[model samples]
Target: MNIEKARFNMIEQQIRPWNVLDKDILDMLIVVKRENYFPQDQKTLAFFDTELPLPDGSKAMSPKLEARIVQELGLKKQESVLLIGAASGYLAALLAHMSSHVTVLETSLALKELAEKNLAADGVRNVSVLLADGLSGQHTGSYDVIVIAGAVEAVPETLKKQLNVGGRLLAIVGRLPVMQAELITRSADAAYDTRSVFDTVVAAAPGAVPSSQFKF
Candidate 1:
C-alpha cells in the first residue's frame, strides 16, 4: 500500500468531509503517524473509517470521530489534558501535539503498556499513560481539557468538577443504537454549558457506569 497516499485519502475522504475543517487539527492528523500506534495486526485499518480493535478488547474511536473530538475540544498549546481510555495511545499522541501535556487513564494493563510503548516509540514525550480506572473520578489535579474516548451513559459530576474553570470536556453520551457526542465547557465555578456536537455510536469504555434507573 502507498502509505502517504492512503493517509491523504483518509484525511480528504473520511476526516475532512466529516466537518473537521480546522487547519491545525488537519495538519496534526498528518503529523501524528497513526499507523505507528495501531496493534500489529490492525495496521492496515489505521486510516479506515472504522473503530479499530485494541489489545484489551476496547475499540479505538474512528478517524473522523477522533478528528471531530479534537476539533470540538479546541485544545491550546498551553493547556493540559486528561484523556480517559488509552486504547492505542493514538488519541493521546494527538492531544499531546495540541496541548502542553496529556495524562491518559486506562483500566487495562495490556492497553496501558501498549500505549506507553507506542507513545515512546513515536517520541511523544508530552503524554503519560496511567493504569487506573479513569471513570472513578479520583483523578488528581485539574485540567484544561478532558476527553472520554468512548461512549458512556452520562458524564459524572465528579469528573466534571476536575476541570479547570474554563476547561472543556468531550464525551459520547447515551446507550445502544445511537449516542450524542457532547462538548461541555465549564463556564464558571459552578456553571457549565453543554452542546451536542454530533450523534454516533461507539463502544463503551471499560467500567463506564450507566445512568440511574430513576428519572425526573
Candidate 2:
C-alpha cells in the first residue's frame, strides 16, 4: 500500500469531511502515524475510516472521531488531560500532542502494556499509561481536559467532578443504534454546562456496564 497516499486520503476523504478542520489537528493526524499504534494484524486498517478492535474487546475510535474529539476540545498546549479507556493508547498519544501532559487509565492489563509499548516506541513522552478502572474514577487526578475514549450509557458525575474549573470533557453518550458526542465544561461554583456536538456510535468504553447493574 502507498502509505502516504492512504494517509492523505484519510485526511481529505474521511477526517476533513467529518468537520475536523483544525489545521493543527489535521497535521497531527499526519505526524502521528496511526499505523504504529495498531497491532501487526490490524495495521492495514490504520488509515481506513473505521474503528480498530483491541485485544480487550473494546474498540479504538475511528480516525475522524479521534480528530473531531480533539478539535472539539480546543485543547491548549498548557493544559493537562486525563483520558479514560486507553484502548491501544492511540487517543492518549493524540491528546498528549495537544496538551502539556496526559494520564491514561485502562482496565485491561494487556492493553495497558500495549499502549505503553506503542507510545514509548513512538517516542511519546508526555503520556502515562496506567492499569486502572476508569469507571471507578479513582486515581484520576484533576485535569483541564478529560476524554472518555468510548461510548457510555451516561457520563457519571464522579468523572465530571474530576474536572478542574474551566476544564472540558468530551464523551460519546447513549445506546448502540446511535449516540451523541457531548462536550461538558466546568464553570465556577461546582457547576457544569453540557451541549451535544454530534451524533455517532462506537463500542461502549471498557468497564462501562448497563445502567441496570447499579443499585438504587
Candidate 3:
C-alpha cells in the first residue's frame, strides 16, 4: 500500500470532514503514524473510518473521533493530561506531543505493556502508562486536561474532582444508538460547565459501571 497516500486520504476523507480543521492537529495526525500503534495483523486498518479491535477486547476510537477529541480539549504545551482507557496508547501518543506530560490509565496489564512498548518505540517519552482501573476514581494528582478514550453512561463526579480548576474534560456520554460527545470544564472548586460538542457512539470503556436500568 502507498502509506503516505493512505494517510493523506484518511485526513482528507475521514478526519477533516468531521470538522477537525485545526492545522496543527491535522499536521499532528500526519506525524503520529497511527499504523505504528496497531497490531501487525491490524495495521492495514489504521486509517479506516471504523474502530479497530484491540487484543484486550477494547476498540480504538476512529480517526475522526480521536482528532475531534484532541481539538476540542485545546491543550496547551505546559499542561498535564490524564487519559482514561489508554487502550493501544494511540491517543496518549497524540496527547504527548501537545502537552507537557501525559498519564494513561488502563486496567489491562497486557495493554499497559503494549502501550509502553509502542510509545517507547515511537520515542514518545513524555507519556506514562499505568495499569489501573480507570473507573475506580482512585487516581492521584490533578490534571489540566482529562480525556476519556471511550464512552461511559455518565461522567462520574469522582473523575471530575481530579481536574484542576479551569481544566477541561472530553467524553462521549449516553447509551447505544446515540451518544453525546461533551466537553466539561471546571470553572471553580465545585462548579463545572458542560456543553455538548457532537453526537457519536463508540465502545464503552472497559470496567465502566453501567447505568442501572431499573429505577426503584
Give TM per candidate.
0.95, 0.96, 0.96
Q: Give the per-residue lDDT digits (tens) of candidate 2, residues 3-44.
A: 899999999999999999989999999899899999788877
Quantify all predictions' global Cα lDDT against the true fold.
0.90, 0.89, 0.90
Clashes of each: 0, 0, 0
Residue 94, candidate 2: alpha-carbon lDDT: 91
TM-score, candidate 3, is: 0.96
Cα lDDT tens digits, model 3, 1-216, are 888999999999989999999999999999999999997888878989998888777788898988999999998999999998877889999999999999899989888998999999999999989888776778777999998888899898888999999999998999889899999999999999999999998888756777785245
Show where candidate 2 strays beyond 4 Å: none
List of clashing residue pairs for candidate 1: none
**Alpha carbon lDDT at 162, candidate 3:** 91
Candidate 2 vs. true structure, TM-score: 0.96
